[model samples]
Target: MQSEDNLLKVLIAEPSAIIRNGLSVTLKRIPGSWIQPVEISSIENLEHVLETNKPDVLIINPNFWGYVDMTTVRAWSAASKLKIIALVSSLSSDVILKKYDESISIYDSPEDIKEKIFRLFDTSDTEKDKSSEESETLSSREKEIVVLVVKGLTNKEIAQKLFLSTHTIITHRRNIARKLEIHSTAGLTVYAIVNKLVGLDEIKDNFTL
Candidate 1:
């Protein structure tokens, strides 16, 4: 059980106003608590609300995941204390929100939803800053590759420049993704700039995603 002083804050997101209103009422009534339920009928304001209100849990429509960039989601997931619970409609939805804190079926009964929210308090682990775990300390060669990639070198081009095989360059790309947990060129551009692998002015126009 959470501390008595802690508010039972939940942000219920659903497309249907009727369904969202119903869910807010049902969730607010889960016993022995100071109920604080906020309904989000659209994802456009989600980023702002999440940053400002800082709710304890975020119960979102699974489709909401598709509306934003994974980079945005990754940044939010990295910083937010709120436990994310995706309302899954199918097995595929699970894949969409796989990195979320928890997932509950849309078809679950109110009681089940209550239980799952309560359980989040128990099962939720304190997430350290993922940069520590996700962004591995690159080897000197890896750093070279990052700099080269940021300089707009294709895998074949980089391999030839470095006197390595194309296959080696491809493996390095995969390893870089595994370490950074980011794959898009845009995301990588930001990473490279922030990490000082390359200065912002050094980035070529063609390097954009």
Candidate 2:
């Protein structure tokens, strides 16, 4: 956890120009506290944000997941220890809320977001706090396979998309089952939601998924 005296640099990866600016203004309510909001419109700018403007926290909308690859996000979070705050209108996955570094509902006013941010100052030190949603076991390929499987892809479709043999997909599926102890598509979908691998919309629109 960061000390209360240190400035909390928040990077807003929200898509709407309006919300980004609004969050910038809203997150700076504390008197004498230096809470800076560095705004970016898309995931493409994440590398620049990390290299040039390393933020202490990443505040993003649920829609951000739609545009960004979840595998990259998970890897970065594990390696960077960058606190991820997913601000959503509604939360379907308690695991995501429980496992993610932080999850705040949009219905909660800006004051609520501010309160959560302040509370997070005590969340971790050298390591990020763990939640039921987190796992250090899966390789990046396994994560990809999980996402495709949750999207209701057949083993053949997943193989085609990933450019692997169908047999390879089958092996990976077995490995996933062995590692997570989950065999059903519904169970895997819940795992993905808890792990923040995919959003509800992705499941609803499998073609785009």
lDDT of 1 by residue, 1-209 (tens): 66645877788777777767877887777676566898887666676677677678878776763555445643554235567777654443324655665555544456657766766565324534442343244545667888888778899999999888777677666556655778876777888888888987788675654
lDDT of model 1 at position 100: 64
TM-score of 1: 0.50
10 residues in a row with least lDDT, candidate 2: 127-136
Report the Cα lDDT for candidate 2: 0.68
* Model 2 agreement with the true structure over 126-194: per-residue lDDT tens digits: 434442223325656778999999888899999999888787677667656755889888888888988
Question: What's the TM-score of each model vs. the native?
Answer: 0.50, 0.50
The runs of at least 3 residues in candidate 1 whose Cα sits more than 4 Å from the true structure, single-residue gaps closed, are 1-5, 69-71, 74-79, 89-91, 123-209
lDDT of each: 0.67, 0.68
Residue 171, model 1: lDDT of 62
RMSD of every prediction:
15.7, 14.6
Give the CA lDDT, 0 to 100, for residue 5 in model 1. 56
